[model samples]
Target: MNSKKRAWFVLGITIIINILCQEYFFTEQFINFNPGRHNILYSAPYFVIGGLLYLYRKEIHNWMNIIGGWMLLFCLVLNIGYFLLPISDLLGHSLFPLLIVFTAYHMYALGSDKKWLHNKIIDFLSGISMEIYLCHMVMFRVVERLHLENYISDSNLNYVVTSVLTICLAICFAYCVQRGLDKLLLKKIA
Candidate 1:
């Protein structure tokens, strides 16, 4: 397929996945385990921009600095609007995805000043991010199953604890996966 048509097809697939996700969020399974759904929702933007980035890599990288630079300013505007006018859902919800894409762009087309983003810690996390993504759902489901929410009594506190615990557990799982792969590769080298 032509590059133009290929990119369009990828984008079409992404949109369809997003629509299905919206429907799945309504199901009882997801409703009962909100953290499971929350982890998936948090993972969505990364995958979305990844597909889009793959399709638009050449063009995006070429002008990403400029585009992302403008987006950084636009982000400030949207954030301020959302902050002052918390009554509006449109900009508030919209800002999250916009910021995601903007950050993705800037990270890809890293400037000399953005050396921190290219560090080992972020690299380690990014390398195992997909593993973390998969592990978090299972961890969250277990948390929910344990009635952590009921014992906690406070909704906000439960949310924070659940999210933090799931994230930490996911990181541990990812680290194990990384170590396993490293061992396998070393054995193969020997």
Candidate 2:
């Protein structure tokens, strides 16, 4: 299989499975599931992808190697930071999958030479990652602002409602704002 196609396949499958696990299994049914377990599962694909890239390092693009190096360094820092900060399951669990994404990107970017990835259009969409990162916090604030919490209890139904609301707002409002900002910034940067 072509490396690029393989990369996208791995990335897409990984994302879909992770989201399904979070939304359905972890949140809806197994509310008490240990986050650490899910983190490992989430990061598994990245490890495989990263290993493949490392094994085929010679065929990889130099820019990918450069980006992968940075991602590795970043994961190293995050790992160390987790160790020093007194490990919280929430933070550790969340960071693990991202570490995987960093690894996958390193592998994908290294294996392929696609300058369009760094082009203004793609860069703008990528910039929305920041918005995705902060969406939960923003969602929480919005929920609080509307005093929606007062009516909802910590039950399965409440979980569904909250998750649905958060996902919707995150996808709609937060992403939209992020895209707008990214476009504005792209014009200046590009």
lDDT (Cα atoms) of all candidates against the true structure: 0.64, 0.63
Give the alpha carbon lDDT tens digit for every residue of 1-190 in model 1.
Answer: 2366775575556545554665566457667553323544545555555555666666655665556566556556655654565444654443355545455544454432256767898888889988897787788777778788678999989989988888888899888988898999999999
In the order shown, the candidates' Cα RMSDs to the true structure are: 5.1, 15.3
Instruction: Estimate, for each residue in 1-190, the C-alpha lDDT of model 2 and write its tens digit.
Output: 2576676677567766766676667773676655644365555556556655665777666655567556555657765665566536665445455655466556565555557557876665456655755676577567647655578766677767876787667767766887688899999999
TM-score of 2: 0.33
Model 2: how large is the Cα RMSD against the reference? Answer: 15.3
Q: Which stretches of candidate 1 lie over 4 Å from their true place?
A: 1-4, 13-46, 67-70, 79-113
TM-scores for every candidate against the unseen true structure = 0.62, 0.33
Which residue window of length 10 is worst by lDDT in model 1?
A: 104-113
Query: Taking the candidates one at a time, how many backbone clashes does each contain?
Result: 0, 1
Best by lDDT: 1
Clashes of 1: 0
